[model samples]
Target chain A: MIEFTIWDILRNLLLAARWTVVLSLVSFLGGGIVGALLLFLRIGGNRLSTAFTKYYVEFFQGTPLLMQLFLAFFGLGLFGINVPAWLAAGIALILWTAAFLTEIWRGSVESVVRGQWEASASLGMGYVQQMRYVILPQALTVAIPPTVGFSVQVVKGTALTSIIGFVELSKAGTVVTNATFQPFTVYGLVALIYFALCWPLSKSSQILERKLNVAHRNH
Target chain B: MSLIEITDVRKSFGQTEVLKGIDLDVKPGEVIAVIGKSGSGKSTLLRCINGLETIDGGSISVAGAQLLPDEAHLKALRLKVGMIFQQFNLFPHLTAGGNVILSQTVVKKTPKREAEAMARKMLERVGLAEKFDAYPDELSGGQQQRVAIARALAMQPIALLCDEVTSALDPELVAEVLAVVRELAAEGMTLLMVTHEMKFARDVCSRVVFMHQGRVHEIGRPEEVFARPKTPELRQFLGVQ
Candidate 1:
């Protein structure tokens, strides 16, 4: 066995952190676009649309994210489809993120009172026009805090992707721990990096929530 | 020709009948006040006329077009029938001028500059020209209602429906909103108001409709309904000893 230095461990984990960050961004942006579509279907579509969105939310939210990653990585192989670890992990994270996001957005849309819909309808606005002009502008105010808050979850969720050999920060930490026999030091740094990434977003979301509440109160 | 005509109209929610076979007509420049106790269907009748509430059992024609359940026709009908709500449902995200200009630009397809000018004029009419940029929550109940009236009038509708427009206002503020309505009445904008303000109804209404238990119990001039009250239900409703 060779002697190991702290610099070696730190530099390796730091390089892996880039992949974690990239994965989180890809999953978040993909999830947001898909979540928006699910939210629109949940609100404006007929009964079948509502049912489909409901089941989609339940399936992802009810299962553990680790299990979802396992399924995405291994389950597809059963069907003769060999997906790379990174693609499997990213796809699973996107699906899971979309589930929670769709539910979060649905709540925001529903919080707009029935009277706003009536007022828009009374203006001779069709359903799409009403949603575009009246309902969405109001719903966006309620949507921002949750959406920002949800980003933290997406960041934290990237840890689970490492279980499928994605070579992200957590996986890199495990490799360094096994090689250097420094579990405490390596894991501690990993925790700190995650905190550095997520803490500011958490604080900013709380601040935004308070500001929106104050704006509403003043109104 | 009558500006609005409703014949044998009916509406129900689940098993509860809210509007039971109603008939009425409004000629040009008529101001009709509909009064009844809570759950008496006065608001329902007004909503039906504007195609906001679908009628279960009859015909409503506004400005010579027969009102149907088709979305396109309803949109056409809405352009000619403005409505004000008791809650003063101005868009909270929008400034007062934004609320007023929305229908003008979106439905009427009026040019932006023209819509703003018209919104300004209507706001001036409602005594809210100074509050053109204020949000709904920033305004008092009375001011919001005035802005709501301005929002409705910006459409330049042939007829206006007010559903208890002042019921949410403070007693002190009620007169200010009613004053706006009275001014609109005097300017020959055909008006149908659902109100609990008896004195305002007695003074400004060209006709009074007394509704009770989902039906029209009486309809005539304000003096006839307030003074004579032909039906026992109307007499008891007006608290005639």
Candidate 2:
């Protein structure tokens, strides 16, 4: 049996943690783009586009992400288009994150009063101009806090990609635990790393919410 | 000449008819005040003049532009006719100056510097020159309403439609907003106002229109309408019965 040092286990897990961070960043940023597109379509697109966006959000949100990851990894192979773990996991996580973000932001966008639109229109502004100048600016302020909060969920969601055979934090923990027979230390450390990533996001969300409340009350 | 002409204009929301076979002629430089009880279609009539509400069964011509769903002519007519609302819907995200300058620079294609200068002048005209950078939420209701008037004036429209512009103000605040309307009246601006302020209407308006059950029940010079109020509805509306 090889003598495995605790330091060696931590070191290897740390290397794998880098992939976790990268995966989360990719998922979150890609999701943001897709989410904004979905929002625009849902708000202003034709009936078909609006319906498609509605179903897309519902499909992702209603299903468990683990099953979706399995389907992405396994289902693509069924069609002879073999997707590597990274591509499969990336695509799955991005879709999941986008679904939640679009719904989250729709609430924010709708929070702007109807009077804003009417007032802008009365100024001879067209629909697009009214949204750009008046509606979006107001909606964006209400959106910031929830968006940051949702990103933490994206980070945590990255952990589920391990089921697709992608080597993120959880996978690295399992591999290290199997080698050293010390599941407690390895899994515990993995949880702590997750806490480290998520804590700041939660704190920032709280701060933003408080700030918005104060700003609202001042008005 | 009539700057705004409405012939048998009608509007309804769902099953309830708000304006039924109404007619009004607004000449240039005429200060016409529409006064009535709540739900009397005063605001709807004013909104229709600006194309904010489409009439179901009649025709409207504002500055030779027929009111239709067409975008280009409607935009042209909007430039010709400015509107102020009861709620003082000044953009809260913008400064008083920004709110005034936005439509000029964006819709009217005025240069930024020119628009800013015009905004400053208009703000001064409304007694809000010092509050140019103040957000709508930061100002009192009277000041906010004044800012809304400044925003409408910056367009240099041929006529202004005010839909109960002072209704949202406190009693003390109402006088200040009405004062701005009085100034506009004195300057010979064509004004269509829907107001609950009887005294202000009598003082400033060249003509008074009394709406009832979605029809123009009585309309004449301010003194005649306020004093005689021929119909029972108008008498009751005036609390004269």
lDDT of 1 by residue, B129-184 (tens): 99999989999999999998899888888999999999888889998999999999
User: What does the lDDT read for residue A151 in candidate 1?
Assistant: 98
Candidate 2 residue A90 C-alpha distance from true site, Å: 1.1
| Per-residue accuracy of model 2 over A16-118 as CA lDDT, tens digit each | 9999999999999999999999999999899999999999999999999999999999999999998999999999999899999999889988988877777
Predicted chain B of candidate 2, TM-score versus the true chain B: 0.98
Question: Pick by lDDT: which candidate is best?
Answer: 1
Write the residue-wise lDDT of candidate 1 on A1-219 in tens digits: 898788888899999999989999999999998899999889889999999999999999999999999999999999999999999998999999999999998998889888898888887888888888998888888988999999999999999888889999999999999999999999999998899989998999999999987777642
Instruction: Please give the TM-score that candidate 2 achieves against the real structure.
Output: 0.97
TM-score of chain B of each: 0.97, 0.98
